[model samples]
Target: MSMWSFILLLISVQCVFGTSSDADETLSVMEDDSVTLHADVSAIKREDQILWRFGPENSRIAEIYKQNMPTYDINERFVDRLEMSIQTGSLTIKNIGIQHSGLYKVTIISNGGTSEKRFRVIVCARLPIPNITRDSSQCSSSSYCSLLCSVVNVSAVTLSWYKGNSLLSSISVSDLSISLSLPLEVEYQENNIYSCVINNPITNQTTHLNITQLCQPCADTTRCGSAEAVIRLVVSVVVGVATVAVLVDHFRSVSDTSPLVP
Candidate 1:
């Protein structure tokens, strides 16, 4: 056989007897949440054995074997917070933390043969609803207004500004903190609306700003506040004049009824 034909046959043989793993399988969970990684096995025979491994080096995490009856064992890293099913070959991790994010591999061996599947887990805390606060000191219609987007109890996140579906500005940080902020400035206009979005792999939050509400000419003249006060002053003056006229009429009536002294 030619060298090219020999290489093609070798590739087909590897495809038939490979470790049989998938890399794109993904699972996401929030910190302090519980998650289960499926083994994709339906049933297991009495002689079948299952091994679950984690990390890049494939450190053994848990296993199920049939020494006498169905037996289960887990490494010290996951001894107290893991559950493995012998029948379905599923692994459940409880109270998962951000440190638990990694690659997981499960190998199932039975009378048929050995098959393996892999999963990539991502665990992160969900950021709270982001707040949009206008910086009036830097805000004006002649130039631009500075807006601040922030959230508490979150770190290692991304904050961004979006006008409709298009991205305007974004910031990302690797360090952690209790609060994070992203500042952006846009020209003052009453026709467009902007949004502040904070996101992570697991979740996201967003808030919106209406330009009409922020512009000076539009907000200050929303039917005008001083105009309403002027109307009230005019109403009070008319009421006071009517009241004085009634009191004068009452006094004159009393004076005419009084008897004159000789």
Candidate 2:
């Protein structure tokens, strides 16, 4: 091969590998929210052709040529959910869900050569409010109050308990949508504030603990309810017996006062 031809072959190989080295942008959005992937270009040039692809298959999802109108694929997975910017060739996914979370790429073709951008998207579920409840088993302790901060059907989040802006305890879940609980024990007479928080990468929800209401001794309410029920049952039995005895005595008296006619 000629030296010039060999040099051209090496340049072609470099270009092919250079396109694969584009840095991927990591982005996170809450489920059912919209996310936009920017092209980072100030404006689309007249001679540029923009193409957007998604997932491991790199399926073509949207495209725009020159100053012409943009077009989107009719694939059911992305139907009515894809939008592209005419000014900058940015792509927007509306009402994004977990299924839509994956790799996305945009290729710009022009006289200058080909350039690419990649995005790694993650759609996290909305975080549930952390629940603060007194642990019944620990309620027997006279000095300390056992409490739990919990959240259910959550993934990629951290459940934490805080005391006056300081973290007391925390638990986290990665990929599985499951339950998480963190326990904290505080003095019954503690005047410090407490809260439970559940958070994902996108957002967080918190619940404040009412120490006076939840941390009370379990005996205060459970035993009282039991005693009241027993008292009601005993009173009802006694009234029933008294009524039966009185009725029998009245019938006997009537029989004795009746005339002794044959």
Candidate 3:
């Protein structure tokens, strides 16, 4: 074979087999957003054939041939969500969802040879704001307040507690959608800033804690002084009313027993 012919044969062999594993690109996108699997070619030639396969099954999902219009699989799995760029052979998935997260491969075939590209897509759910609540079971203590930071129906995320810029505690889940909670203990009068955060690879949400507001009822402290003051005020009013009633009754009895007034 001639030198040019040998080069063409080698290129064709690589394309037929597929791209190298290290060439696989990883993309992360939030649910309901669009993701484009780039062909990485400068342009698509008129006689080139573009094909795309998806998932571990390598199911053919889209194709374009010889300057003809692109077509997508009629499978309900894709429906109207797939689009292709005729000029570049890149594929775009609109309003992507968690079910669509998987491997994707694109092959471009031409008279000279062929080229291939692979991609791994990760679709993540929106992160919910972490909640910070006082752990009531630990409320009996006066020196410190027990708190919990939590989130529900989350996957591939980490829940964390931070004191100012410092991390206090964290818990993570990889694939399962479940609830997560991290506990923290702080003095009732803690002046340092505290916050709870929940995050995935793409995004994060945080909630700040107000120590005085959440731990205000802890026992034997000024944090409980307002409630105690109210109780004391009520008792004093009741005793004063009883004393006035007794004095009025005693004066009434004396008047009834003494000389009559004009």
* The candidate that achieves the highest TM-score relative to the unseen native structure: 2
- Among all windows of ten consecutive residues in candidate 1, which has the lowest summed lDDT? 11-20
Candidate 2 off by > 4 Å: 1-22, 220-262
For candidate 1, the TM-score is 0.58
User: lDDT of candidate 3 vs native?
Assistant: 0.81
| Candidate 3 colliding pairs | none
TM-score of each: 0.58, 0.74, 0.73
Model 3 bad stretches (over 4 Å):
1-23, 219-262
lDDT of 1 by residue, 186-245 (tens): 776645678898876666888997765654432454356689989999999999999999
- lDDT for position 35 in model 3: 96
Report every candidate's CA lDDT: 0.72, 0.80, 0.81
Identify the leading candidate in terms of lDDT. Answer: 3
In terms of TM-score, how similar is model 2 to the real structure? 0.74
Question: TM-score order of candidates, best first?
Answer: 2, 3, 1
Between 2 and 3, whose lDDT is larger? 3
Arranged by lDDT, best first: 3, 2, 1
